[model samples]
Target chain A: MSDLSPAALSPGGTIGILGGGQLGRMIALAAGPLGLDCHVFCPDPDSPAFRVAARHTVAEYTDTEALKAFAESVDVVTYEFENVPAETLELIAPHAPIRPGAKSLAVSQDRLSERRFLAEIGVPTAAHARVDGEDDIVAGLETTGAPAILKTRRFGYDGKGQTTVRDASDAERAFAAIGGQPAILEERIDFRIECSVVVARSEDGQAVVYDIAENRHENHILKISRVPADIEPRTAQEAAEIGIKTADALGHVGVVAVELFVVGSGDDERLIANEIAPRVHNSGHWTQDGTAASQFENHVRAVAGWPLVAPHRHFDVEMENLIGHDVDRWPDLVAEAGAHLHLYGKRDVRPGRKMGHVNRVRPRER
Target chain B: MSDLSPAALSPGGTIGILGGGQLGRMIALAAGPLGLDCHVFCPDPDSPAFRVAARHTVAEYTDTEALKAFAESVDVVTYEFENVPAETLELIAPHAPIRPGAKSLAVSQDRLSERRFLAEIGVPTAAHARVDGEDDIVAGLETTGAPAILKTRRFGYDGKGQTTVRDASDAERAFAAIGGQPAILEERIDFRIECSVVVARSEDGQAVVYDIAENRHENHILKISRVPADIEPRTAQEAAEIGIKTADALGHVGVVAVELFVVGSGDDERLIANEIAPRVHNSGHWTQDGTAASQFENHVRAVAGWPLVAPHRHFDVEMENLIGHDVDRWPDLVAEAGAHLHLYGKRDVRPGRKMGHVNRVRPRER
Candidate 1:
């Protein structure tokens, strides 16, 4: 992918987004100021991104005719999530260029491959082993021990498609919980906190990483994200370096987020890579109000082949997600001073669904 | 209009915009974050606002059927520009309430009426007289004197429909230039500087005014506006008070701009009202990047019956318009540090057409 010539997108060019969710809606919002038009292709007609996009095609990703028309209409293609099938990419690649490329997607789609890729690139990750069946699970438990997590190798998100294995007997139950899919057995390491580093890379290998964001999750769903993560300067630097290295190795042409866990304490504290999200992550939402260049805008710029601006954080920010019934407090939140509310325009608020997020910024001196 | 009860709009409610230009586009952009959808109604098929709006109606303003359909689709109605005909407002008013009401539009539409309204409200304005024809122009010049301006009483903007009268002999030519339309003759005051105050008012008479912006015009079109206008504190306060008074007098439910001229020197300095814009003004464009709450967002909140936030300036800002060929420098401008570019997405760049604007912000302490 790096050897391929990078074509710069003009202001009037259209960007095709694969998923029409909150992330795609935000990217479309940012693209408007840059004089770029957005065309969203999503299977759901009720997708929130359609409201803000210049054009949208409501069709399944597997619909070849719809995908062909969408690709031909856009100058560049990008996706909001990493679970897009490789076959869909293969179809779109013949018409329009897909940023972050297939290598990043392929590596991050499966948990086993992501862990192996990180280790191959000298990025430290949790101890894990690929599990195939009863024998593989028995062998994995013998090596990694009990109190490990049995996660399906593909299509897992927000703690779904995975379960904790307390002992040898629990392995079979965990496997059954995941519907007997291919899985990975990993030791659950005790860590101080969880944080993520979002980095943007251009086609020519130039990369810029945002400040670390400390995230707190409830029910495996992101609840709050605060920028200028509370970590030693050395740990922050190491996290950024790991993010850049991961993006560079994948030849990614858009934003990539690397989730990491801080292990140990004091001088011995170090970052351990936990997971890789080859697209915009929820943790980076704080950058919208905290920094001069937001992750979404930077991704648009990188994929558009424009020079990247150094991400500068001018204010301390805390972004809180409004999930499910939490959005019911919107009337009160709208009146809160210094709070910038961004509702996704979701019509239904099912339990555990992310409806929107609010960003609050305070001056650094304050 | 005040007797009509104010209804607060929910987050998902739709706002109907009367014109589809850069202002409408910006308002639509601001509405998205507040969880509001926008529907633009304009006659021009090439309208830039249509690209960002969720819905749009393309029909002449006189088309009552289209107007009724558009009005019924929206919860509240507002306009980008002030030239909308009174008849159009009458048609929409039966279905949806028009913010800023008909009084603001009626007064600001005709120069003679605006001057009279300002004077009646104790707001000092430039000396002027109504001109019905050549005889009126001659009689007006006898009192206002030479070196005065002859401008159409209605439908005049950006130096159009007006001419400069240098001497008595120029009266006939000036009247002919305006096509014998009813006009106003005003004495051109020697002013040290030009500035404007943008004030937003809610239905209940609560008002918030942005910082004064020093303006520079090229051929009567706004070229640049710098916030924290160079003016005495007393003059700035006076200007704000005048803006609030004007908005209150008209029972304006949205944003209103009052252009003023600074006269005298030292302690004798004072502000003289020059013109009134019953909608968002170009000079307030700086608020988009320089303040925590932009003028556009404030306008939306006011018209939506939401409480207004105090216009707080977080940074010193200079907003420069990219008119006509000036947009050609976008490639270079995009690379400039601390510069936030907002392109209007206009397809054609005719001379004097407002292509876009760029805002440069500097820290207040710096």
Candidate 2:
């Protein structure tokens, strides 16, 4: 367990943030209110974080010179995403303290490594096997059986690099669909609900998990997340316990999201690890308006070596993603009363793009 | 009551803001999430609002060219403060839609006008009279009685521009202290608690008020505000009714705050309108975390010719302003469990300055 006190980080301290997307932009927004100045380094000149940040570096992540300069500019570094290149992490590690560390990213970024690591730690996960080529895929399929997912080992998100192998006829198609890259084949586990546990861990090993969030997906894109997930109290507690242990196993400092599949029914809806997001996540968006401390702020605190906030649910919250054209409904949402709307300062809203979200909170009856 | 619907406006519309302080900065923050860009025209280049605003014009309020250019840049103009210069308002009015209108500003900018306007609308207010000179002051004092407060008709706030005429001996000092400006003398009402009502109105005359907020001030600067104010249910209802009527009387649009004195005791502690703020206000800061719709967002919604959100409070909340050196406690506040902290990106922290605030919320008890 890591043991870091959030109170040690004072106002006027500099926070180094990698990835300048809307998540990073929101993190910077949350950091501003704590008197913490943010230095955002992103390859894109149009990164929304740059608009409000105190300082921004527009250079590729792997550029050593730019990375070094960025590392030296801040007291600590935290990335908004896990896919940052390993070499970039090495270049930054020596200059400023990097959290959720390079090691955690190394495992989580690759599916093969993440599965092996989770299995080694005795965590319940899908039955799986790694495949490198056509022959390997066939052998793995024999062991994992049909009705499974074949996913590329790295750089896949939003269902972009995976295919479902329903039967023998689909095996070759699934393999070719993924371009036969180094991949992982896992037996699909039928589940009752797709839920996520978002936990923030400090260096001192203290962990806090927000209420499990029930997620609904559309075309592999997260469309909505509702807090107070429809699960028994015991199930929720067990999910949080798994989250705490996972953070500890990774030696994680900052927020980590564990995606889980709840199998069976009633008292037997056992949760199995699906994937890990080593940063503030979409599932936790409800915290922005429904909790005492937003996930972004807590993540910032964890990376900045501050105390962890006690995650709390202030209301039964439903958060819906405004994907592309859905954003056109901003006028209606704004007037919907009791809806907290957050739009990323993205210029163009294309199809499947996450432009904003609306959080509707229903207070408990008084 | 003015009536307007948000569907009447299009995206890329402009919102003219009056004050460029943190409240304006926050309003701009909220506006960005809804696809509405902000054009902040303030006298200070270092105004916090300038940091994140899409467009900003640094010019004196009295500069007609600057005000007109500012108005031309946006579809609608709203203000962060109520004391905008009347001449400046006239300059901007013709070029763009101005919310809460020039008349609302005229009423709020002067103490006598606000009281008279409230009184005319059947709203209860403290006894007040115009004080043009020493003779008027002497006669007004005799009629309004001793221990009354003498305040400037314009440019006064946070206990500034006012003196308490405790007796005959304090009359000359009170008169000289205000620099003999156009002033108003008011008989101070005895009150149990200082409370405020925050309301938003669309152009079409629809109005919505948040629950009454109880305020505590120290040295004229707001120190704390608690929502779900420990007031009677009828008192809260009356406060909202008063706010709606005030907005109707002024034909106001956008968010307006009415500060009131809860006079008398218990059941008899009726509400007396203190003053009106024709913009997003400090008293409603708790909405940032405790309510589904923050006051900043609601203000933008109303002025954008959109439907106003009737956001409900998620928790019973208390907001404490971090003033001057109090901001140094950010680390401690962030470390405290369940504390939602916000700091303005103000570079300097001077005494009595509002650096930021923290909201602590608890679930509403059944």
- TM-score for each prediction? 0.97, 0.91
For B163-276, candidate 1 gives per-residue lDDT tens digits of 999888888998999899999999888898899999999998889999999999999999999978888888998999999999999999989999999988679898889889
Q: Residue-wise lDDT of candidate 2 within B1-366, one digit each (tens)?
A: 223353455555667777778888888778766656777889998887776566788999998888878888888888888877778878987888778787888889888889889988899987777888877777787767888999998999998999888776676888999998999888878888999999988788878889889999998999999988878888989999999998888898888999999877677769988899888889999998877678887788888777777666767889999999998777567666667788787888899999999998777762
Candidate 2 regions with alpha-carbon error over 4 angstroms: A1-8, A51-55, A166-173, A363-366, B1-16, B54-59, B62-69, B166-170, B230-232
CA error at residue A233 for candidate 2, angstroms: 4.1
Clashing pairs in 1: none
Return the top candidate by DockQ.
1
Task: Give me the TM-scores for chain A across all models, comma-separated.
Answer: 0.97, 0.96
TM-score of 2: 0.91
Best by lDDT: 1
Interface RMSD of each: 6.1, 5.0
- Interface DockQ of each model: 0.46, 0.35
